[model samples]
Target: ALVLEMKSLLGALGSSWALAFLCSTRWDWLRHSVLCTGRWHQVRRSVISFRRSWPGKIIMKGSSREWSGTMGQHNMLRFRAGQVDPMSRRLGNLLNMLMLGGQWDRRYYSCTVVVPENVMKDAQRVGRWVSRDDINTMGLLRHNWGESALADRYYPGLYKKLEEYHGVDFHESVMCWHIATDLILAKEEKEKEDFAADKRVQTVRALSNYMMFLLVNRPYMLPGLPQNWLYKQTCNNLDKICNDYDLVGSLGDSLWTVLKKLLGLHHHRVLESSGLEKKLADLIMKLPKEHASSFSETPRLLYARSVAVIILESGVVDKVRLLLDLWMDFLAYAANRCIRESHAQKLSTGGELVTIVWLILEHLRYLKEDPNQQHGHV
Candidate 1:
């Protein structure tokens, strides 16, 4: 039956004249398979001939089992497949479906070979597979489920699958926000009673897991995804979390710490080692007026101190001065917002101004070092 199917597929290829010519050049096996399968001796002889000739011819030009094996190896598919236990074939198939970017559709058939408990165990194994740098399976899940109807409809199921498998509840604020956003966008019910009950548990868990992962990894670049696209996704998640969760509470403190790490603003070591000074400057430049104005005076002063360091390192004092001039204009806008709202009392407006003066003093010291330095002669 398999041979007949192969022959039918090959026959369809004969309509293309070039394929016909190629097949004609390789017809010896076809002749043998048809002519010799009848008698016992002929069948043995044909089997030997078939093994030698069939695979080479059938694979077509410039392709080989070895080549496919190499591709599978590169994709981690071969390694994963080889690691599958004989008893866990169903779990393996589920994993393979996920690896291949298959979505969970109601119409898609799934055989119930194992109980939900075992299935959940298998799901945890799948989650572990995603932590490896080479596997990137979770990234695939996020790609498919982040903005899809499947994410909306099967979110609870998906989260349950993850939790049952991984034994972690992963209920971070950012994650909760992600679920909430998806639910809202999907026009899902937002019943307060349901929110406090088991109905919202899975969504909450999935978000929590995601947030925990991010907190530990502090990832600057997400593999198999563009940086800007990942940044946008993260920003949306962060915005939702902030809007829904209180920032002054314990949960808010945890979130603030994570955000500080994400923004590369936690420790001085991170600031220096992570190449984040300029990134922070860019972020500051891009912030909405309200957000930009929320920084306490000391933090703004520290930002100015960093700006001075950047200016000295840049070796373009004049250009740095011009950039600072423009930055002050932005600060003025933020200050105006604070003043109008009577929130200036809680922030340090004077410290920022003083920091600017200190920056000017440092620039003069840098300028006085050498006339030759200005012209890049040394």
Candidate 2:
């Protein structure tokens, strides 16, 4: 028994070092910024909207002039349960459907809370895929946008459960957009952290893990994706290639050229020299209609981010800070909860948390191996 305990403890520690060693490449790009855990330097502003002076961002010294904001602007990290709008309140009827309806989901599965349109819809629209915030209807105005691909992790059982009980389509693409938008915000955090400090590494790790989740466990995030797309493999390959080429920061188009050549995608294009844009979604996965189709509209990356802009635009320090705390909480949540076999069947085919992307591998390792507990495999 003592040997077992020691092995368990060592395994836990090993996972942490393994994750750090594995991501040492990405860590190099995390940019040096002071850790602002207990530091709260408040700068009061008369500006009401971010339309002029960017709401709350302060330019940090070093790390390429990156922008980071105050996280202590709120009195609470968890939101009031009744804070949602009427439409969002109605969505609370379905299991895992109504996000932020309870304490656990609000604190963890928070990206899907669907903060109402009345308060958050008109901030910005960067793409056609960027629609209103509606997780229930999936931010879809019409059903003909694209045929949905139900991923094994989120659909079938979820769909059947909803259908058998509530008689709703669950709006697969739109729901996926929630997860997609979820990622967009994470990516945005990553971009900002590139220049600022605070929790930069944590944000990057979360974004990396979340991207891996979308690519591996949830193909529904990429609707109409071909079965033979090989995007997941390509993404892993890019991670390796980026490491090999020392291509940190914004993976420039040159890496895409190498990636296209590596994947034989360069051979199929007969038309011309089209430059590929460096997008996180594109960098990590083979997005359908990547250049032309707005990533098949399954994600509409940063749609949720636009909603985030509204909160910032509201100029409520508490709202912005609340969101910041929630994101940090999510990072913690993924590290602790995402490694179970019930959540991911195989380390090879599962999310980065199961393999490489988890922020705190020791906690996840403990969760995965605790047989006395009921989760992981169930």
Candidate 3:
């Protein structure tokens, strides 16, 4: 009995020490140390074993292999209740929230979130935050007119299309733009050339989908009033339209697939894209020739479709450039306007791209203000 008690005490102390080390800010050092010592293979096997066990299983609802590739890598991570003891599950949640470091979606790495080319030029010229006060939608619109120098110089006609959808509410603006972006992207499927290879087009698509993901799943993180009613009404109107065209079955299936993919229910297949865009394209082709009434529930849909038509009228080069610049602005504006507390809350359970963008901008601001400050201080 005494020997058993000693073993239990030693185990407890070992676990406590392990937890302390994991929670400390030495993860980078640890990763490097394991790599230098040639013991990463063993450590990786042990981590994967733990990941497959009950405690770690609670962190992922779907297949752990499909959700995130490695245990402590830079892949996106998620948390869910799994078939584990309640106490162990809670511990898993706590550990993930406190110490599990992961990056945002790999798709967003192409976005100029860390150092936007135009924003960088402006910052160097003015030595301050150019969009300091232009964080909200209206201010962003005003700034984009002439202040976004590169965009204006290249896509001078873009603002005319933008002005057509100007509004006071940020939620309404995001929905309108999102719908328009979807329509345009769906049409691009018919292009003969490999449009997907274009980085500008890729950026546009990524930011557009990312904004919708936030709108549907994390609306509170955005700078606007609750848009629950608007989102539901939009979905309902979309369902009605799909039903009218007898495409409801396909539409529902596509939307369900997309929702699951967005919520991290599973990982996307290697070479396939979501069916949502294709379904939306089919729906667009079935719209009535005449526009819907302003009071109709589907007014936003009609408006966005019309906007897509106007945008599509431009040359392919112009369309891609205009949209790429516009999305960069939208990303920056949203990141700037989001509340600090919202960012803090997301630090746990895998950080967000917007939060990272905001932090980068803050760091740039500090650098611009104090050029002599050491790099490591930030």
Candidate 4:
């Protein structure tokens, strides 16, 4: 019965008279017989032989061989019944369908397909075919814009289960844009103007929201250095406001006042000789117990403490000093908690803390130097 079924399938595959004619010879029979067995090892060997003799026919022949191998395995498993586990059966069926170009058939599966554990290894093997770099490279080529071969082959429903399981939202437009931007920026010329002009407001807002989310939700990702995309964006926004409006007079004064209030230094003048330790102690006491503990364990606290020492040693109590002191105290508390914690020995936190400390110090140096020139001229 199995041999009869195989003969019928082979006859169906040889529907074209030219294909039947080509498979009639003795060598062709041997090759086709091995491929018809549907065993992966036999199919692979047949594919190798075909490639060696007729390289041009390998692609089409290889695809059929692959499909046959998967289909044969699936049929064998089905017939054996108890030979394969539920997960293995599901995986075999999925692989067979995938090999046979069922990716475009929406009815075959849903947008989210939960992968069985038995097929996870095979899934990973297939995943290597589609990578971020490959996607980006394809995105840049204008000739390939209409329909991505990769997306058509494995998107939306094809990997739906894995997407849901991994919490990956495949429909995020911003992520697509980000990938495209990375590719665009890799060129020598600056693409800033193009980026700024193309839906500038929306892009800026999205980036701002993303940065804020990272800062709040994943604070550990933030580097210690002040000169990063986030900081640059903040400065750019300030510059835009200054250029677009009269900031120095009424609007600017109001903006500065509001900013100071937000920084928790509205009452404290820029130049006031305040006691640093007392203010820090007050801040520490005001924090909730859990927050205090977390703050104390962070390395940022050490960096903050170092900044406070620098400010106090300079013997200047100005707005900058006050802001620095408050900032440092908050970081110090977090750092102290991390340090005391048993499982919080992350070196990146220490690096970030040091970076922030140096940035704050740089700002102070700039402020002091700017004022000194006026004094010297006078």
Candidate with maximal TM-score: 3
lDDT of 3 by residue, 1-378 (tens): 785565344333334344455446367777456455645455545544654574324442232222222111010001111112243334444655876311212211111122224433322232122433333433232353223623445656665665666445677777777677766766775663676666555446555655666665566677778676776576556645544555422212244643443344443222112454456455665566663552275466666777678777765455666665555556665666788898777654345666665675565444543443323134
Name model 2 segments beyond 4 Å from true. 1-306, 316-324, 331-351, 354-378
Ranking of predictions according to lDDT: 3, 2, 4, 1
RMSD of 3: 12.1
Model 3 poorest 10 in a row by lDDT: 73-82
Model 1 misplacement above 4 A: 1-190, 199-204, 211-222, 226-378
Give TM per candidate.
Answer: 0.19, 0.25, 0.59, 0.15
Best prediction by lDDT: 3
Instruction: Rate residue 136 of model 1 by lDDT.
Output: 34
lDDT of each: 0.28, 0.29, 0.49, 0.28
Q: In model 2, how large is the Cα lDDT of residue 290?
A: 34
lDDT of 4: 0.28
Model 3: residues >4 Å from true position, as ranges? Answer: 1-57, 60-151, 248-264, 269-276, 369-378
Q: Candidate 2 — which pairs collide?
A: 66-195, 138-174, 341-376
